[model samples]
Target chain A: MQWSTLIVFLLLFVLVTVLGFVAAHWRKADLNQLHEWGLGGRRFGTWVTWFLLGGDVYTAYTFIAVPALVFGAGALGFFAVPYTIIAYPIVFAVLPRLWYVAHKHNYVTGADFVRGRYDSPLLGLLVAITGILATMPYIALQLVGMEVVISALGFPMSGWAADLPLLTAFVILAAFTYTSGLRAPALIAIIKDSLVYITVIATVVIIPMQLGGFGKIFAAVPPAKVLLAAPVGQSLGMYSAFATLALGSALALFIYPHVLTGVLSAKNARTLTRNMAFLPAYTLVLGLLALLGFMALAAGVDKVPQYAPFFKQYANSFAVPALLMHSFPGWFVGVGFAAIVIGALVPAAIMSIAASNLWTRSIYRAYINPRCTEAQEASQAKLASLVVKFGALVFVLALPATYAIQFQLLGGIWIIQILPALVFGLYTRWFHRYALALGWLAGMTAGTAIAAHLKFAGSIYPLHVFGYAIPGYAALYSLILNIAVAAALTVLLRLLGVAGGQDQTTPGDYRAAVPDRDSGAGDGQMAAPPTL
Target chain B: MTTRQSSSGIHPRLWWRLLLLVPIIATLWVPWYNHLNPTFIGIPFLYWYLLMWVPLSAVCSAVVYFKTRDLV
Candidate 1:
């Protein structure tokens, strides 16, 4: 029954639990302050920021689902690599500026940055609400990642029975995240990244060897599935769809409030720059993980004796785990499963903290209690993190685990709509605040409607206009209309003399670096604005 | 309520900003490289084409990062 494997996983889980709790005191900041609790005092050094961000961004289901796509469909799954490739350079272009302005204004969340930049509370609230909605489902999907591993561990229960153990695992995650905030995930990222390295390496090197070689693996895939040629005729969109999916997702990745939380928490601009330089190493790992799907196919996973029964019932999401369970001994199977489980927990911690920070900074303080102090903000965010995690739990329970994938897909599309008001607004304020909001509305509606119309979880939807399929990703198509609407409306609004609201940022603020002097950085720099 | 200013060498900013186009524009046209007839160690052109850009993107970001560090 693999009890020994279960015990090994439990031991590692216990070790990470201790680390999560101890992280509350890691940098020794006053935990009562919102910045400290919500952002690890926004002082993560280079390697810490690397691990924390590496852990936060490349999530758990991604560890499973990317490979699952390759296993099920073939080369199309490799889109994740190009998407990630463009992502770092994009980060290089704009995120440092975001960090600079966010730090200058003592803004703890992306919504707070939106509020300060556009000087519009309603725009900030829209960003905050969108961030919370996108992140909640995403957090729920992490549980789905963990849930797949738990069910794969020889427990074949379905429906409500499958979720009980997951609920328990999430409760422990919620407890530690509530107490420790970003620090918990920062410390746990170390363990998560280490195990991910071991898992990806094993799948990439060992499985290929065991299954003959990559030559034999590619040859084993049916010619149609493995061939890279884009089919001609009405499916011309397939070719461009591949490229645009990567570009669109790359644009969307860092805009997630959780991603911005990681970005904003770095000690300074250079840390972020260095992180972008090396974060591609994680992309390298992702490439290897994507190859694991091919490895699963080559290994003839459905034919493996141990996994044959489960193979008949489940989807390709279990391919890598099944490969591990089939190849490695039970204890290593436990270690691999533990890696996936820990991977989910790390992001769940960071995302709840990021989401709750949005709730506290942009929603609660702006609406519920305008007079809230620093300590109150921290406590409110702490309490809100639990609520966010609880919401994630309910989301996971209400939607079938299968539908959980739809939520994850929707997150990328939903979060990208905020770019005009949130990201482009970083570089130029040419976009009027209302025009930005309208852009967000058009983009969100188009993106969500297209995704929902397909009623499928994967990215390929033939965008047929007048019965002719167009070549593009859903987000890219929406982004086209998003910018068009924002630009045209911006010119129209400016002509009518609509006030663009106050810009609380200065041009110099974008280029200012944190001082080399370490004293009183981050904690004492916050100056409350009179206008808000 | 204070403003800080530092002049950038227009040279480095211009260079790095231009460097960003290496990945973004290179990947924009996918059909150019979407062939598998020329495989690399059993990897298709489609897969290796994208993987090739991963390191390139990193190099571009690293260069931009160093160039911009002086401003911040």
Candidate 2:
């Protein structure tokens, strides 16, 4: 055990814990309101939104897993780079509209927007349940990321003692999150992102210097691992998988509850669009981080006696940690590991907060107590955040980590099903609410069944059509099926002269900016509805 | 519904938003840049090409953002 590493890790952990509590007072708002606690009162400017969204999307598990994937499977793993790159443009196009309408109507969650848009509480409930279900495993995976780092730091790994440090970290996380709400993650995200940038930059620069250079690094890697496999007879093979995975994941990224929480917390619609223009900076960092897998191969860390055992245990997931320990000294290892652990905490806090918002607004207030006051809703969300964190804790501790992974895979598949209701509902009210709900149901069942058929071993399914084999992400395939069903049902329902649900939002709401900022007071005035 | 006409009218600069699709199409067309030839700094073409789009895509979005800033 390296005492220097442990000491620095603990020091950074304590510092963030203090910052977490202090964040409750950062913006100095009335925490009794749901928007205040859950959305940081929608006052984050461009920079804060950038860090928060970066911290939310580029998760600790992603830091560990992306490199691990590159380390194991080679070029196919680099799909993440294009996924993030394309994601920003899509965000630029789609999310500002969501932010505008959400801000205008006081919509705290995507389900709130759906509820308001479709005028159907049942559809809202479906979105709420799906968001919560998709998010739980995600929070659990953050725990897995934390577990990897803590175990790397030489913490206990067996019996009850194994989970104690994780438990303590989470308890502290839950306390700060419960007290400070979304502000905690938003504020801590700044520090977390700074540390991650330092670690990644230092690693890319220093590690390559140690290992000769990039040319040698690429040269050391096997030819097969250097580039994606070419297409084979009838099948587009890894090429199709890589493209679809990138596209599907790009679509799915912003739709996650945690990501939307970050987006909606922006001060205004312009802040969100401006952020979309710059968030690709994180994608660049992610691309560099993915290359570390090849660096690990070039360095041949698996051949080292000490790291071989970890490699045996974790397989590819241990690539980043093993590479760090091999490349850096004991003190820097602490900083790098802290960056990853803090990375886990930021997303976990935001995700739990997002889930609780869904529960409180869409479920509790909607049905459990229709007339619950503002303070009551806020307090319920606080409690629900604790419950969500505790559930993730138990999910990680009781079950094998593989279960968390499988569920997370299914989570991505399931979460994308809500895109039709949320993203489509943003533009036209043409889709029947019932049709959207039924489409969601169909997508959910088929996605789950396909994932189960693959035994959750992989997310790519070989879809055969017209004598050609196209293997792509299960999420995208199911989403296509989802949209087709919704469109077909919408036409049938329209033919029967069924009434589409009422849309509370006007087109003006989608273009609504902050009241005092933009030039046209007239445009803003049309969207103002007395702030609910 | 009257307000819809005033607000939802297409922005004159909205055509600039088409620029956002450049990166999407470029990156999604995998076969175009899939080769290992013309390596930069010993990095494979496939690797650096995608990374290049990371910044280029941001530029595209930023250009569109500036052009259509008034829309939001």
Off by over 4 Å in 2: A394-408, A513-532, B1-8
* Top of the candidates by lDDT: 2
Clashing pairs in 2: none
**How do the residues B5-69 of candidate 1 rate in per-residue lDDT, one tens digit apiece?**
22232333445578887888786677677777588887777677777888888888878776666
Highest DockQ against the true fold, candidate: 2
True-structure RMSD for candidate 1: 5.4
Q: Candidate 2 lDDT, tens digit per residue, A79-170? A: 88989899989888999889888878888899999999999999999999999888877788788788778888887667889888888888
- Which residue window of length 10 is worst by lDDT in model 2 chain A? A523-532
The fraction of correct interface contacts reproduced by each prediction comes to 0.56, 0.70
TM-score to true structure, per model: 0.92, 0.94
What is the lDDT for A332 in model 2? 97
The CA lDDT of each predicted structure is 0.80, 0.86
